[model samples]
Target: MDDVTRQKILDQIPVIDYIPKENSQAFLYLKRVLHWQQTNSKNAVLVVDDSSAARSHISALLKRRNFTVVTANNGVIALEKLKEHKNIKMVITDLEMPEMNGITLTNEIRKKYTREQLAIIGISGATSGIHSARFIKNGADDFLRKPFCPEEFYCRITQNIESLNNIAKIQHAANTDYLTDLSNRRAFIHNANHRIAEYVKRKVSYCLAVLDVDYFKKVNDNYGHDAGDQILKVLALYMRKHFGGD
Candidate 1:
């Protein structure tokens, strides 16, 4: 801080949150606080495997670590389980299931949901060269070879759930407009810029218009402000209607 500003600050507050020249420590503390707030809380998991023994063992292990566990016998049953228990955070699926296998279930997961909403972990006793590659390529976040130690299994589940939570928190912070649930200014500008660039590359003609409500000032004068909020909403709706992105 400059001398004048530092003097003024010292005058305003006798004690400072950071010592002079200790900005690095302050920044470190800030980052730690942010990470703590963003970490995902504990989660529920679903175990889908053809082998009842594997399913029971894995579920028992995860439950021991304080994770809620549910089981399904096949892909069809897994889908039903998902609908019934929407809180399921991750899936520990076995590849060689009877009715529906892990691969098919992963495809459905990628098509229907998000990575943060649900994480996939592929497990198999067979060789991993082919199956593991395919599992991860599809959507599985991590994989553990069968006959692994229970400690390793629990560690993987705990880490995956924690990582998913951090990602969800960061994504929310990035995509959400703090003032409203709609996309924030940063995201809006990004998508808008991408579209304009694509249009330029394609030699497409497009008109860019800026719209704000007239007499917005009067809203502050009359309705105790934030009245312009409705106008913005209506504008968003109209834009959705008129723009081809609709």
Candidate 2:
């Protein structure tokens, strides 16, 4: 960040302290606001290691900071945990462990996980030779050496989690239709059977309409593309607003 941006953030921390301790209401209000950010982040960091002690240590550190943590002893267990809890947005693995060492774990994950799937960080005692580079080549988003500083570890973890979230959002937008903000026809049908089961089980009514846009061809010919685009946006917004916003 530039000097100005850094200075602005530095300024805000001191200002937050200026609020009087006597004002209990203001303190409660601000505290809730800060907690809401943590809640909505919904970030989960999975600490995978053969050692239970290592897993518990990392889990405790993150939990104290308000992030959710999951632990697994081996690669097989890790993948099962991932499937059981789809919101595990990040994974931190220790290399040179038992069955399903870091490389094997990463390879399995990369097979099913796109760039949007999950952010994986590899931590190892062995940093020399190809050990560190192998982790990166096998889809590790970041690498950390053993005996790292607390602050540096926190920074790298935060960066990887944030990066994964942003990439997932972009991929979602690209695959979805902008006008309706829903999956396009092809995307919708990619797993239509799965999506439709809920509606069928609930016995809910749905309507499929063949919309013609009320002479869209003529509208485009008369008003040009910009106006036509605006019409689509307006209609989509109206549909979403009244129809539970998808």
Candidate 3:
């Protein structure tokens, strides 16, 4: 290349500047946000694989992503771990294992915990599609073929956890009052109807009562919306303490 062309090309290259310590408020804020993301990525994960090397590798990867990891060598031990760690939100299990394989574990888990509460991902080295199909049909939320890339593994784990969190948030909003953090009218109606149906089916006696705050409108008018809200919250708390049940 000619000297003049080389000089022109070098001049056209963009120069990057590092942020100064005194003027790095935005950079600091970005760092905080990333830290928060890493901290809240996963609650806990159970890794079930017969191979010690594979379990170690998976646990290391999850720990790097700021996840609490517990491991089990077989499905039976995985169930025990699940019982011991009630906060485990996700499970990664190998399809082929000794003493209760992945499919049986998934089925047993589903009997107690729904997809909204727990996320299950099955991994297998077998190329047969039947294994994957069987896993999903038996209540596995996702399936991964073994020897997968680390990126794909983490991606699937993140997606499943996010999905479960979204479902929980939706259910909470549906069943809870926004202001008082108590059960809403819809929840009350649903539960009351269920109890009524069960009682009627069994020919049992039950009592129903309705209570309301007297002069609620006067309180709102005389005090203020804030005072009225406080009164409602107190009333809700009293009800919860005295009359709450399934």
Candidate 4:
């Protein structure tokens, strides 16, 4: 193909325009918003479809929006890709495929991955609402019908990803100490309850110890809060290094 023909075909591809060179105020504002989304998003998405053309189209759309995209021809292939790519946080899957259908795949994935670890969106050309409902019943986080508008597709993806990130943030805050980055009291209690049940059931011998720093308040009052924090951090690090578990 000639250069002009190639350029024309490239322009025909469905891609979002995120650049901010336009002069209009509204366009500039949109550009800024898109920039923020791009910078904040670092998620990898797995796209599973039996149709190569469909895979390419959706992958291009996701890439234009600053997401990392990996394509698999079917759910079996998608599962392998998931094992290989640990960074993948979301999956966009088609319901109809050979070897493994989307519903079956979604069910299998849910057995291993929780909603917090991986988000799944089901897409289908089926016009029936039953298809979307079944996808949700099979563990998909969201569903989109085929022939969807680009705007709607992006909105669904953004909403699901943002929800996952927010959940992770909340879980982190609940489980971790704000100052020491160690497991907080809540996490310790939760874990201890589980361990206690396991030990009682198995009759395993185990021991727990609680440590308190001597004159910690004096250290804070004399050396300052920063020094007290450093001392606590050092103790936590030493404990982690010496008593870490698998």
Candidate 5:
């Protein structure tokens, strides 16, 4: 960044009476934000609003925080934008719009994306809280009233994104084997059940096969546990190579 831009960002940090013992979280967050803007130029958060002013205001706030942003005037355009941009991680939609409303958009988006895959936040200028409830009931991850403070907006966006990352990490740990980095037994059973169900629905013929590693325990008894672990890793890789398709 240029010196002027760097100085602008430094000036935005809250002033305090004394220097912190270590770098503040705000400082660290801003630094990471800058890095993300540079590295993730293609990834975006989608903003949907019928009003041009609202779209511009929200898009500017996101860009100021160094988030890549995509904007649409309504839910229909928003869905089109999502199809065009595969890297969108979040959607912020206004409740009232032309073409399609926010609640309907949320429902449609949830049909294709899980909460773990994409986050959605609903915003509205309406007086009734029922709109917020409807947004949540339809699958929004969060709701914010219109005329919200930027601090609250930033917090909500970051928190939801963090939640998605945390959930993905938890699922990865649950499904993946530690040593071989392949799907563990739990994941295998889960996926197999789903696939088998689909095959049955389609009236497809399928068979499950079990292969035994001959004298596998003897290899461990003779060579060592490490050698046995290596053998398992190699077998996992071979299986992936030959039968990897879903």
Candidate 6:
């Protein structure tokens, strides 16, 4: 903090000195903030394998890295676990499971989650090249051979998760307006065209409208660009409130 800000906070300390530290409002607020950070900082990973040893080993490794781990014995249970745990960001599955193999699990997961939403990494003991090939073809972000070293395992997990995060960042930057934080013209056109195609394919009725802000140029001319930006932000909020679903 700068000197002014630091001194201002220091000046306020005397005002609350009479209160016990444990009962102080500032202390309680800080405690809540810290707790929230601790809770939210860890991304959850789902580990699926028929072998108990494999699940336990993977879970242990992930937990050591501060990732919250959920385990399942097979793909069926993994699907149920995914439904139960909404925080699960990634899945690491073994390919030789009984109920649903990792390939089938990856395909099923893709039906609901894009790679940006949830990442999948397949692991198996098989020496055949086809396992890794099929895993990737079925929406697995990456694949690892069984008995992977801790370094290799962690690297794969980190890379896949980072790839998903980077993709999400790129997509947000591409689709969002910088000033108003609303959908940009390119995003609107792309999405509208997609919806139009779908609606036409299904022979469904649809409506499309373009909204123009009147006197926008006048506002910028009269009040400066900053005021015009504020106006645009307010208009964006109103649109989000009224037409967000559409």
Q: Kindly state the number of residue pairs that clash in model 3.
A: 0
Clash pairs for candidate 4: none
Error of 5 at 171 (Å): 1.4
Candidate 1 on 1-246: residue-level lDDT in tens?
676766565444222222355668767655543453343235678899988888887876665455678899899999889889878889889888887899889888878778878899999899747998889999999888989865467557657876887898898889876544566778878888999999999999988776667888888788855776766666667766686452
Steric overlap count per candidate: 0, 0, 0, 0, 0, 0
Give the best candidate by TM-score.
4
Shift of residue 133 alpha carbon in model 1, Å: 0.6
Where does the lowest 10-residue lDDT sum fall in candidate 1? 10-19
Considering TM-score, where higher is better, how would the candidates rank from best to worst? Answer: 4, 5, 3, 6, 2, 1
lDDT tens string, model 2, 1-246?
465654565355223222234568868746743653476348777899988877876776576556788899988889999998888888899987777898999989999987677888888877486777898899888888876644467668666766776787887786689765766776667646666787789998765556667799888899998889888888878877786534
Q: Rate the local accuracy (lDDT) of all candidates.
A: 0.76, 0.75, 0.83, 0.85, 0.84, 0.82
TM-scores, in order shown?
A: 0.57, 0.63, 0.71, 0.73, 0.71, 0.65
Clashing pairs in 6: none
| Candidate 2 regions with alpha-carbon error over 4 angstroms | 1-41, 127-129, 176-180, 184-246
Worst 10 residues of 2 by lDDT: 12-21
Tens digit of lDDT per residue, candidate 5, span 154-173?
A: 77886787787679799999
Which ranges in model 3 have alpha carbons more than 4 Å from their true place?
Answer: 1-42, 188-215, 224-226, 234-246
TM-score for candidate 3: 0.71
Cα-based RMSD of the predictions, in order? 15.2, 9.5, 9.6, 5.6, 5.5, 12.4
Model 1 Cα shift for residue 224 (angstroms):
18
Model 6 spans > 4 angstroms off = 1-42, 186-216, 234-246
The candidate scoring highest on lDDT is 4
Better of 3 and 5 by lDDT: 5
